[model samples]
Target: MSQPTVPPLPQIFNFLQLAAQNPTQYGGNAADAPELTRILQEIRDLSIPNGAQHSAQGLEPYQSIARANNPTWNARPDLRPKISKFRIVKHTHWGKAYWSPVDLLGLFFSRLEPAPLGATVRTFFLPMTALFGRWAFQLVGHYAGMQSCMWKIQDNGPAQFFLGASIVGYDADIPTCGNWRRVIQKARYSLLPNESLFLRDWSFANSPHGPIHPKDDYPLGNCAELYPYLHLLRGVDESNKNVYGIALKKKGVRSPSYNDTLQGSVWQNVQWPCVKCRELIHIQEGVLANFAPYAGSKGAPP
Candidate 1:
């Protein structure tokens, strides 16, 4: 005997169509269910892809616009997205300076892919991606701001030195940026080529963590390479604006959704995030809980 075949998305799309048309028949009310309404609105705003083009690299992100590979989705070939790298500066508490390459998507609850999703997949899940897209843009902006997440791949010792001197998950609750913003405002120091604003708070400069490299009154234009961190995030792009328009424009959007974390078989794999990535995820959850518009986190007490 053959195994049962699952219905195709087109068939499921039909069920969704009928369900949206007459929710009461299914004993549900669209007005009462925000999730259903978000889905239906997304279905209404979907883009119809014209055709597929062959590319040197073929890739599909798990969600929508994430360009970073999901370490968690190794078992699913359908979601082998490319990993995007972003660099950040770091000053070890020991006074050594270093540049760290971070997996852009691994830092957040998102993934990155090449351009233009398949027509069917895009139509089905683009709206759903609002959950990720909204958080991603906001998180990126936060990362570009004063405080952000950093990871240590090795250990911190005089032996490790710049190789990495701290425990992988020792939270650097210490400040990453201090006052380049104010320094620039007052022209206290000649800024480097793209060093417009600082990404850290004021205390970062004096933090026990070694921030002694950047000078207060000098032309860093010559010593540009000295600062480790850079101001990365700017703002949301137009693509994100159109994507999140329908799916996450409400108060509930600020709160975490069931879709925020990896779901289903993806978690069964052992290639999960390392301690550093897990630490970043915990930071994101805490941020959403404390700052999300609804004023609470899913992890909060009822």
Candidate 2:
């Protein structure tokens, strides 16, 4: 039998360089698209394991790490045998973006409430929390939905930042799941500095653990669960009124393919696919409406 060959260090380094230089083009429109895609595919293939068929082959290390991180792992000693047998492939093949077992467990808990899996059938079932977390963080990139774009400060300023959005669950009642709300608060604070941060969408729903209703006024905070991951864009400014308008028009005018809608684009683009763009448009429209009629009037509020 022959040993499997791994990608060369040089190739990996080159990929990283390309990714850094032109983050959007590297994945979305690189000249070496086929080759780059193939490399990524190969890396993913080598990293993630298949289903339970191969679960027991070499998963002890991962299971041990998970148990070490999860305080409640030992709470159900009866399920230990099955939990020990559970195989979780949580890391990504891209760069050093691998997730520790602890990270995976944290994500699991964020989206789901833990439950006792009786010993009789625990072996055949993976926790829903674990499965959903993996799907949202890992598999989401395979589809097309909203694109992540970075905005630089205009006129050669030193600030450049990203607005992060994920399909993570949100419940005002659950302190652990309130990360999305914190992100919004941070974005609002950024606005005072003439900088902006916006995420794709967030979830607003009644809490599963308590009687907490999602805030209807903070509409920008609700994001659907199945939105596709988007390619990141460079050299856009979210704060500039002109720049923001252009980006909004570009997204709004582009016709989504039928396939896109079928694949959950409707959920993704519900109110506005990009929350920042919507805010910008609202501001621009308000200004225009207030000023357009004053063009011919004398001594307007210039």
Candidate 3:
């Protein structure tokens, strides 16, 4: 007697469809419950070539628009050298200067494709300080608050820094604030040669302050609320090197969506240091602390 043959992918999908239609014909285990089986079949069907064809057809218009407006819509793989040579700037505040252990761990764990539930849970518990620092950097440092250390990318070049507006969409005029209206408008407009665009899906209603409209009127002025970490766009080739290409908008008469509601600046292609640089920074920090003059001593470096 011959051994039973394993089914091909299409055949497997057909079997799932049949099992979903008639659950009793299968083992009827909990995994093959009617609802679960139906969902699995639906997913399988969507993965087929025909389903993909339909999806592509539906997205054709959007793709055309994106290509026309965004230079990076179908950008060739960036072949720039990985930023291995870099220095970390020491900040007065440690939290502001370096990513916390939890923040770094969370970022690492998130890159695990098809991560397990336990790993996801652990990643979620990481502190919000990293996000807070990002927000503060945008609101305080970029606006009218204290200046802080920014990362250097190449030798003797201007410091590359992260700005929230670069990650979250913002009005061309309000450089630091994130607004859905401006995001939508930019999606439709043609991007300038220097502008680089990225699309991110956001749900303002799901934020801690509860459901709110982008145009809601507040008594004291509508200040954006702080949100938890999602994901940062890193270089595809150098996953460890956090960097984005900067997009600068041209000066023009303001549109309604581009109203200057806030005072701040935006930057693009911001690069954060790699693990090795971070470790060296920690060591440097230790040395600085140890060699520092005694507190309350005269003529000590500030």
Candidate 4:
């Protein structure tokens, strides 16, 4: 016997129309459930033709907007969404550093062939996208005062160094930023008065690991550790060499996250010591409890 064939989305759309008009006559949730299934299957059945005129180059712009409207689908699992490919900045000239989720969708749909969608699919796509926009807007609301996530300014040695010497897990208790700052300041000033540092507090959200990129590193312990690190990096400007911004967050907390270390730029022309001890100075593998002890870190380099 042959398998039964699945009907197209038009059939599903018609079915929903009947059920909505007479829910009591049909069944309530059960009646609507199949419609939902049909919509999902229809969505999955839709495909981007090979060599489709993709709006974004490597699949990020295309993937993000499509996935936002329809959750149960993905264009490619093993790839990161290349937002740069969309060029909303270059094309639209919307100067915000990040794209609003709505703008992302707008950029995407504008590039696609405007084939009429099945009624249910169209219904699902539009309202669902609106909800996604609202959600993203709410998430970014916290970033009002701070234009972007905390960023590392420089990695100048003395005042600025890598906190990657450490790793703290969620299970440990940590000190406040003030205390960590005092410790690093004492250590930095013990060497020199003016110093600039990037503390871990300004780096990661304290998630114990790096996401998107597979690197195991931490910056500094707290915001307090920032001044001296920055002071030192600036202090050694003539001799130091290396400049890059590294933003990070803490390892374990849920919100208002923590930091690992500060990352910033190297002096424009200075050369860094390739042989400097990568002995895991400021940050290293340890419980969160060990962070305070490493505060001054005078007797031993982390």
Candidate 5:
């Protein structure tokens, strides 16, 4: 079945007067007709997922990692798990993008309560906190996605250097079961944390947890976003060396040095981070986020 056509945005809305045919409608034409039409088309394209859509995807609720593993919010019934597992189609395939200034402005109004889930149960989250700036991307025992960057300063520094994160978790309140695929198109700043080896070892690789073949190490292994900021995800110890107490790297992840070995886009699946890897990454990042202190190599405010 086809989605119904969304009504185009009217030109000359309010006092803005975008694309006026007469030129006298609002003193002078503000924007071109093509541009106004494009504006409407953008809104028409925003495919924000409904709650059922989210549930069907089997997006995890954060109860697995919340304080004392508490059930934060419970729906009366878990939407019967949809047989078609989740996959990362392109943003255009999903038709999810902001339309106009209204959508941009609406970003501020949305609330994405930032929490560390890259390690476990923060269900797919990206918060508006990215806009406020300077807060750490707190990763605990689980990895939950959020709008955070590598803060290179501000432990006590008078000035903060890192630029701000883009608007995250804006369109919806992505519950614990929402927001994990980590390959958000508009939000590149968001990190992709799914790097479990068994995830990539599907077709050509062995799964007893051994060195992954090149074919099996594609998605999170080549991740461009997380490679640079993983230190932020893994906090520092008192002595300051990258502490890898969570899981054995070779057993769990694909490669140790993705920075030098990175070839192409991170998680390059048509829909990125396969279902197996998605679940694993969430669990892995969930555990990794819980470590105390920033990573030993954790930049003081990079």
Candidate 6:
């Protein structure tokens, strides 16, 4: 069935104003416009998730990266799994840009308490600990769809970025179940503690016991490698602001390198010492995708 027409926001807004003033003039907008009215009611009934709104520098360093750097500067694609069970469709196919802002905002507010599955879970879990400003696209106009980027984090993980896709419309019946199913089905299992991998092999790729990494600076290989994933859902970005800011100040994540003389968007592109062997691995997205069983086993002369 086609989606019922949503009354013009202005009309709805006016109805709300009337109801608020006398509350008896129209018997409340809810009875007049149940669907649109349901939204307002839901918003009133919603609550923010615990710890979902905390802002600590240590919790959300990614916002800093966004403040200092641009997301579109050096975007890349992911290449592992070599086969995508999932497809990236333009947002127009789903809806129109008309409903983008309000829908995204509502979704963000609605999911604050218990984050919705898939992107909702990923976006909120980061709190204020992300090292990349990948979630900045949340503020763009409705022409863009929020692509949920997945990441295989080592010690710390940052929010993913978004593509310039437009949001032409909105869906009241968000396929919560189907979305979660597909999300988990094509999921890239993470590397074990300190065990990062590039995942060239399919067998090892599915294992959940590995540390995942970015594939490259452009064209991310897996959903995790793609920065645009941050835009998957609308409000996921704003929710992080308040909490991330608080944590940043409370924890003080300003390392001298964060303010390094290096002038570029990839400064947060850091490599960590292996906890097991202490070997300094160049931890860009490529290293994560090119991981081999042993040091010399990778990219052999075939």
Q: How many times do residue backbones clash in model 2? A: 3
- Per-residue accuracy of model 1 over 1-302 as CA lDDT, tens digit each: 01112234345346555665655554445453443443433322221121111011232211111122233344443432321221122312122222111112111111111112231111322223233222323322211101122111122211100000111111111122122223232221222222222432213233222243444321221111112111111132221111110112222223333222223111111021222222222322312121122221123222
lDDT of 6 by residue, 174-265 (tens): 22111222222222122121223334322223323243333211111222212222223222233322211001111112222222212221
**Model 2 agreement with the true structure over 1-302: per-residue lDDT tens digits:** 01112234344335444553443442233444443443334333332233221123533321111111233334655554333322223343222121222222222222121122221111111112122222323322221122222222244432222222232221222222223344332332322212222241222222112222344322332222111111112224243332211111112112322111212321122223344334433432322221121122232122
- What's each prediction's TM-score? 0.19, 0.27, 0.18, 0.16, 0.20, 0.19
Predicted model with the maximum TM-score: 2
Worst 10 contiguous positions by lDDT, candidate 6: 243-252
Off by over 4 Å in 4: 1-85, 88-236, 239-249, 252-293, 296-302
Given candidate 2, what's the lDDT at residue 81? Answer: 34
- lDDT of candidate 1 at residue 26, scale 0 to 100: 49
lDDT of 5 by residue, 103-214 (tens): 2222211111112223211111111122111111111111123122222222332211111222222222244323322223223322333343335543212333443553
Please write out the lDDT profile of model 4 over residues 58-124, one tens digit for every residue.
4432321221112212343223232111222111222211122222222222112121233121122
Q: Given candidate 3, what's the lDDT at residue 201?
A: 20
Candidate 4 total steric clashes: 61
**What overall lDDT goes with each candidate model?**
0.23, 0.26, 0.24, 0.23, 0.25, 0.24
Better of 3 and 5 by TM-score: 5
Model 5 RMSD in angstroms: 18.9
Query: Model 6, 198: alpha-carbon shift in Å?
Result: 14
Off by over 4 Å in 5: 1-32, 44-165, 170-181, 185-302
Residue 47 of model 1 has an lDDT of 13
Most accurate candidate by lDDT: 2
Badly placed stretches (over 4 Å) of model 6 are 1-137, 140-175, 179-181, 184-258, 261-302
Candidate 5 global lDDT: 0.25
Instruction: List where candidate 3 sits over 4 angstroms from the true fold.
Output: 1-6, 29-33, 52-54, 60-302
